[model samples]
Target: MNYLETENNTKITHFVLVGVSGQPHLQIILFMLGLVMYLITVIGNTLIIVVIILDSRLHTPMYFFLSNLSLLDICGSTTTAPQSLINCLQDYPIISYNACYAEMGISLCLGVTECFLLSVMAYDRFVAISSPLRYMVIMNKAVCLGLTGISWTIAFLTSVIPMLVTPVNFCGHNVVNHFACEMQAVLKLVCSDTSTSLVLLFVGSIFTLVIPFSFIIISYLRIVVAVLNIRSTEGRLKAFSTCGSHLTVVTIYYGTLIYMYVKPQTRESEDKDKIISIFYGSVTPMLNPLIYTLRNKDVKGALRKIAGKSKA
Candidate 1:
C-alpha cells in the first residue's frame, strides 16, 4: 500500500467531485438553493430531536425511534450536502482519498441504518395498531433499546465490510461523477477488480434493503388485516390514522431510495442520476421531519405548545 504513495506512485491520491450540474451561470443559484436546503434540514431535524428530548409526552417508543431517525438524517445530509454546497460555488471540489473513504463509509452506515430503522418503526406501528393489548409488552424498553442497538451494529458492519472489499489504491481515474461518495460511485472509480466487490455489494443490498423491505411488508400486511377485523368503522379509522403518517413517509423514503439504487446503473443519464441522488441524499431528509410533524395533530399540538411556552 506504501507503494501507492511512493516515487513510483501513479495512483490517484484524491478525487475531484464532478458535483451536480455545471453551468457557470447556475453556480450562484445552486449555492443559494443548497444553502437554504442544508439549513432547513439541519434546523428541522434538530427541532424533532429537541421535541423528543424536552417533552415527556414524546417519550413513547414511536417518538424515541423518530428522534433517532431525525439525528441520522441530520448526519446523513450534512455529510454530503455542505461540501456539495461549497463545491457548487467553486471551480473544483477535490476530496482526498482517505476523506472520501471515510465519507463513503459513514454515509453508508447512516443510510442503511435509517432504512432498517424505518422498517423497525413500521413494525412498532404494526404492534401498536394490530395488538394494542400487547403493544407495550412487545415494544417494551428493553426491546426498543435492543432493536436500536442491532440497527446500528448492522449498519456499521454493512458499511465497513463493503469498504474493506473495495481497493483503496486504484491505478487510474480519481474523479467521482456524483456530488457525494456513494459506494456505487466510488467503486466505479476503482481500478482493480470489482466483480467480487460488486457481489458483496449485492449481499449488503439484501441485508440492508431486502430484509428491511420484507419486514415492512409483513408488518403492514398484518396491520391491515388486524385493522379490518375491528368491528366499528371509527375504530378502523382511528387505526389507519395512526399509521397514515408513517405510511406516507415510508413511501417517500423507500420510493426515492429504490429509484436511486434499483435501476440499471449502466443506463442512467448523468443529470437524471444526479437528480435521483439529490432527492435521497439532500431533499428527503429535509422533508421527513416536516412530514411527520405537520401531518400529525399530536406532534403539531406539541410543537405549538413548545413554541407558546418559549414565547411566554
Candidate 2:
C-alpha cells in the first residue's frame, strides 16, 4: 500500500512495522518469548514495588530509588514489548501514526528517566559508603523526592521536542524496519529531512546516555576509593557487596544502550541491532528484579517474609 496524506495534511496515516524476523516459524518463537518476558517483567517489577512498600525494613533511600527504577522498568517494557509481541503474530503489523509517535515519546521519556535514576542511585551509594555518618542527612526524604522528581521532569522535557518535531516531518515513508516504534527505527522511515530531529536526538542522547554514564563512573570511582580505605577485608567485602548489584545492573543497562544508540548503524547490523534492542527493552526489565533479589539479602528476606505472611 502507498502512503496517503491525511485531511490534516499529514503524509502518513499508518506505518507497517517489519518485525525482527520475517519467517513465520521465527515469529512464533519470538512472540512466545516476548510474551513470557513481558509477563515476568511486569510481575517482577510490580513485586519489587509491593515488597518495598509493604516491608518497613525496605523504607530507605536505596529502596525508594529502587522502587522508582522498578516503575521505570515496568513502563519501559510496556512501551514496546506488547506491541512487538502482537506484531509477531500478524502478517503485516501496522501502527497508527499518532500511536507510533506516542509510543516513541513515552519510550524515550522512560529511557532517559532510567538513565538519570541510575546515576542518582550511584550517587546514593557513594554517599552511603563514603560518608556513612552523614548518609541519612545527605539523602534525606526531601532530597530523594527532589532527585526522583527531577529525573522524571527532565526526561519528559527532553523527549518533548523530538516528539513534537519528528512526526510533523514524516512524509512518504510509512514502513518502520523494526518490531516497534523505536526512535531511530521510526526516524529511519521518514522521507523528509530529519537533520534537525537527528541533531536534537544526538544532543538528548548526550545528556541521557553520556552524561549519566559519566556520573555513574565518577560515583563508582569514589566508592571504590572509599571501599579500598576500609581497614579489614571483611569491611571491604561488605562495602563492595552493597554496590555489587547496582554495578551489575549499570553495566548491563549502559553497555547495551551504548551499543544500541551510541554506535553507528549500518544495513548489515540492523538485524543484530533489533535483537540487542529486544534484550535491553524486554529482557533487561525482567532480569532487574531477579538481579536485585538474588544478590541482595534484604530483598530476599523481604520476599520470604511476604511469602510467610501469605502462608499464615
Candidate 3:
C-alpha cells in the first residue's frame, strides 16, 4: 500500500501522520500532555547544555561528554515531540517527502551518535573508576574532542549512505503513520527495492547498537570489578553511584531499541508500535536530564548556583 502510494510522482504530495490514539475525547488531553512534556524535555536538556558551557569549572572531559549527551537529548526530543503534539491536536498531520527525508536523516544521525557517545561515556567512567589517578591524563581535552567529533561523523556518514541509496520518491500515500519520519516508517513508504535500505539499516544497527552495547558491557564489567575491589563500603558506594544513573538511562534507551530493531521486521500493530516508539523517542529524552541531575551532585550544585545567581 505504501509502495504504490510512493510510486514516482504519485498523486499525494503531503502525507498524513495518524498518531497513537484516535479517540476524539483523548486527543485534546494528549495534545496538552505532550506539549508539557515536550517543553520540559527542551528546558531540562537546554539547562544542562548551558550550565556546562558557561562554567569553566565544567570544561573537563566529563562535562564535555555530558554536554554532548544533553544536546543529543534536545535534538532527539525536538525531532519527535512537537510533531507528535501537533498530530494529537490536529485533524491531519501532513509532511512532504523532502521534509520527511530531512527529518529521518537528522533523527537517524543524532540517534546513532547518542548511542556511540553513551558508550564513550561508559568507557570514561570505567577509566575514572579503574584508574582514578590517571583519569585526568587519560581523558584530556584533545581526546575528548576527538571522541565527540568521531561520534558525530560516524552517525552522519551512516545515515547519509542509506538516504543516498534511496532517493525520496513520492508516488505513494503521503501520510506517515507516526509523528516523525523515523527510518522504519520512511522505508516502509519507499517505492524502490528496499534491500539496500534494509542492509544500510543493518549496518547502522551494528554501529548504533551492537558495538556500543559491547563497549558499555565491557566498561561496566570493569567498573563493577574495580568498585568491588574497594575495601571501604563508602568508597564502593560512591564509585557505583557515579555510573548508576547513566546505566539506568542506557538500559531504558537500549532495551526499547533492541526490541524495535534487533529482530526481523514484521508488520506492526498500530497501537503497539506507537507505544514502543514513544518509549525510545519521546519518554527517554524527557528523562535524561532528570536522571543525570538526580544522580550527580555536581549538576545539582551547578543548578543551585545558577538559581542563587539568578536571584542576586
Candidate 4:
C-alpha cells in the first residue's frame, strides 16, 4: 500500500472525483444536463406522492405501494445527483471521505429498497389479477406497511453492513474515476486486499438484485397466465393494463442495474458503467412518474380533478 506522507506526515482527507469528462466544456454540458434531470426527477416523484396522498380514489394498495416507490426514486436520485452536479461544475471536483461513504450507503439503501418494493408491487398485481375478489383482504393496510418496512429494514442492513465491515484504504491514490462514489470505482482506490469486501458485495448483490428480480419474473409469469385466462376481451385488457406500467419501470430499472453490476468490469467498461449508473440513478426516476401517469387513466383523472379544483 502506497500511503501518502504530507508535510506534517498525515494521509489525505479528501478525494478527487474525476467526473465523466475532463474537458471544461464537457463538464459544463454535463452539469447542465444533470441539473435538468435532477429537477425533473424531484418534481415528478413529488407529484406522484402528492397525487397519491390527496386523491381518495387512489387510496388502494397499488397506489400506496406506488407512492412508496416514488419516494424511493426521489431519495435515490437525491443521493447521487446533487454531488455529481456540484462536482461537474468544480475545478477540483473533490469530496470528503466520509461524505463519499455516506453517499454510497444511502444510494445503495434506496436502490436495494426499490428492488424489493418493485417485487412486492409485482406480487400486488398478481394478487389483484389472480384473485380479484380478495385483493383488498389480502393486501390490507397492515400488510402493505409491513412489506414496506421489511424492504427498508433489509436494504439498510445490507447496505450498512458491507460499508462498516469493508476495509477501504485509499493509500496515496485519492482520485475516483466516476462522478459519484460508486462502489467499484471507490474500491479501485483501495491499497489493501479487497477480496473479503468483494465477496460480501457479491453476496449482497445477489440478495438485493438477483433474488428480487427472480421473484418479480415469477410473479409476472403467473400474472401473464392469469390474464390470459380472462374470458372477456375487456377483462384481459384491464389485467394487462394494470401490470403494463410496472413492467415497463421494472425493465428499465433492472436493465441498467444488470448492465452496471452483473457484467465483468474492465478499463474500457468504466465509462459505460458511469453512463448506465446515471440512467438508473437519475434518468429513470424522472421517467417513472411519466410512465405511470401517461399510461394510467386513474392517475390522469386525479390530475384533472386537482387541476380543476385549483382553477376554481
Candidate 5:
C-alpha cells in the first residue's frame, strides 16, 4: 500500500537510511561500532556529571562548565545515535519527514551550543590564569548562568530560524545516504532550488563554527602569554596542565569538523565520511570524560572521596 500522498511531484513523507553500506558485513560492523559508541558516550558523560555534582571541591566555574559540556555530549549523541544503530540493523530503515527534521534541529542546536560552550570554557581558563584572585568574582554564579543561558538561546535561534525562513523541498522517498538525517544527506535529497538554503548554511556556519573557533584561538593565545609570565616552573606546568585537556579536545573536535565541512561532499564521500562523522559526533563525547578525568588529580580525588563515602 502506497502511504505517500502525492501531488504532481511526489511529496517526501519519509526518508530511507543507508547505513554504512549495503553489504551485510559492513552493516553489522557499523551497527556494533555505533552501539558501542552510544553506550560509551552515555556512560562516560553521565559519570562525569555525577562526579561533578557530588564533589564540593569541584564546585568551581571550570567544573561547572565541564558538567554542562557533559550534559551536551549526552544529549547530542542521543539525538541521532539510536536511530543510526537501528538503521544499521534494518534494511533501508525509514524515518518520517517530521522526525528527520526534528533530529536535525535538535542535533544542530546541541552542536551550536557546544561551540559556544567551548569558547566560554576557553575564556574561563584565560580568566583563571590571567587573574587568579578575581576569578570567582568575575565568573560568579550569575555570570555563569547568563553565559550558559545565552549559548542555549543562540543555539535555538540559529538552528530553527533559518529553517523556518527557507524550508527544504524534498523529493519522494529520499534515500538519505546516511544512517541518520545528517544535514548533508538531507540536503542532497532536496528537490527544489537550494541556493538560498546553501547561502544560509554558509552564513550560519560562519557564526556557529568559524567565529567561535577564532575566539577560542585568541583566548588560548592570551592564556599562553599569561602562563609564560609565571615566575615558578611548577606554576607554569600547573597552568599548562589545566589547559592541556581542553586544548586536546579543541584540536580533535575542530580538526575533524573543519576537514569535514570544507571538503566538497559527493555520493562516495557521504559513505566515506560516516566514520568521520561518527568519530566527532559519538567518539568525542565518549572520550571527553576520559580526557577530563584520567590525568586530572581533582577528578581522581573527587572519585576517591565518593568511593570512600560509599564504602563507609
Candidate 6:
C-alpha cells in the first residue's frame, strides 16, 4: 500500500483513499460509471422537486414529503459522488482531515434523516388509506412540518452528537480503504479505545435503522389490513397503487442497507462493503426518482402539464 511520510508528532494531516480499485484502468471505468449515475441522480431528483413545486395538483401531504425526499436524494448523492468520482481519476487521492470528517458527518446526518423520513412516509400512507376523510386533517401542513422537523432534529442529535462526544485517536493510520469517508470504514482506522464511540454509533444505528425500519413494517402491515377491508377490488388496487412505489423504494434502499450491516466485517467482506456502499449511496438515489415517477400517475400528469406549458 502506498503511504505518505509522517510528521514528527505523527499527527495525521490527510488521508489517502484506496478508492474502488487500485488499478488505474479500473478506476477510470468506475469513475465514468459513477459520473453518469450522478448526473442522472441529480437531473431526475431535480425534476421531481420542480414538478412538486410547480404543479398545484400535487401540492398535498404525500407530494410535499416526496419533494423533501427528492431533495435529500440530490443532497445525498452530492455528499459522496463528487469526491469519489474525482478520487477515481488519481492513483493516490487524498482528502484533508477536516474534509473527511465533514463528509462522514453529512452522510451520517442524511442517512439518519432518510430513515426517519421513510417511516413518516409509511405512516402517511397508512393514514391516507385507513382514514381517507381525516387524512388531510391529520396530515395538515402544520403536522407535516412537525414530523419532518422532528426527524431532522433526531438526525442532528444522533449523528452530530456522537461525532463530537466520542473523539478517537487515529494514531498514525491515515489511509482510508474506501472511495468515501464512510463512518464504518473510518472508524476502523481508530487506533485508540473505541468502546464509547462504537457503542454510541451502535445505539444511533438502532434509532436510525432498526427502530425506523420496524415502524415502517408495522405501518405497512396496518396499511395492508386497511386495504384488505375494502369491499371492491378496484378500491384495493387504487390504494395499493398509491403506495406501491414507496414500497419498492423501501425494499431497494433498506434491503441494501440491512444486508450491508448484518454481517461481521472481515478482510474478504470489505470489498463487499464497498460494493454495497456504491449501490445505496449512488444507485438507490438514482433510482428513487425513477421508482417514484414511473408508476405514479399524478407525477406523470404533472410532468405532461409542465411540458405542454413549456411548449406553448
Write down the TM-score of every candidate: 0.91, 0.93, 0.91, 0.94, 0.94, 0.94
User: For model 6, what is the error of residue 4's alpha carbon versus the real structure, in angstroms, after optimal superposition?
Assistant: 17
How are the candidates ranked when ordered by lDDT, highest leading? Answer: 4, 6, 2, 5, 1, 3
Please, what are the lDDT tens digits per residue for candidate 6 over residues 1-312?
112234355567788888755598889889899999999999999999999999999999999999899899899999889989988988778998878888888888887888889999999999999999999999999999999999999999988777866767777887888998987788788767777766666666666888888889999999999999999999899889877878877877887777665434332327768888888799888888888888788899999999999999
Candidate 3 or 1, higher lDDT: 1
**In model 4, which runs have C-alpha deviations exceeding 4 angstroms?**
1-9, 265-269
Error of 6 at 99 (Å): 0.3
Q: Can you write out model 4's per-residue Cα lDDT over 171-226, one digit (the tens) per residue? A: 67778888888887887877666677777877787788889999999999999999
Candidate 6, overall lDDT?
A: 0.84
Q: Alpha carbon lDDT of residue 301, candidate 5?
A: 92
Of candidate 6, the 10-residue stretch with the lowest lDDT total is: 1-10
Let me know the TM-score candidate 1 reaches against the reference structure.
Answer: 0.91
Clashes of each: 0, 0, 10, 0, 0, 0
Residue-by-residue lDDT tens digits, candidate 1, 49-125: 88888888888999899999889999998888887887887666898877887787888889899999999999998
Over 97-165, each residue of candidate 2 has an lDDT whose tens digit, in order, gives 778878887888898889999999999999998998999999999999999999999998898665764
lDDT of 5 by residue, 1-312 (tens): 123343465566778887655688988887787888788889988988999999888999999999999999999998899878878888889898889888988888898899899999999999999999999999999999999999999998998766656655554647878778888777876666777777777778878888999999999999999999999999999889879889888877877776666555443425556667876798789889988988688998989899999999
Pairs of colliding residues, candidate 3: 5-171, 5-172, 5-173, 6-171, 6-172, 7-171, 10-171, 15-174, 15-175, 16-175
Candidate 2 Cα deviation (angstroms), residue 245: 1.4
Q: Please, what is the whole-model Cα lDDT of each candidate in the order they appear?
A: 0.79, 0.84, 0.78, 0.85, 0.83, 0.84
Count of clashing pairs, candidate 6: 0
RMSD of each: 2.4, 2.9, 2.8, 2.7, 2.6, 3.1
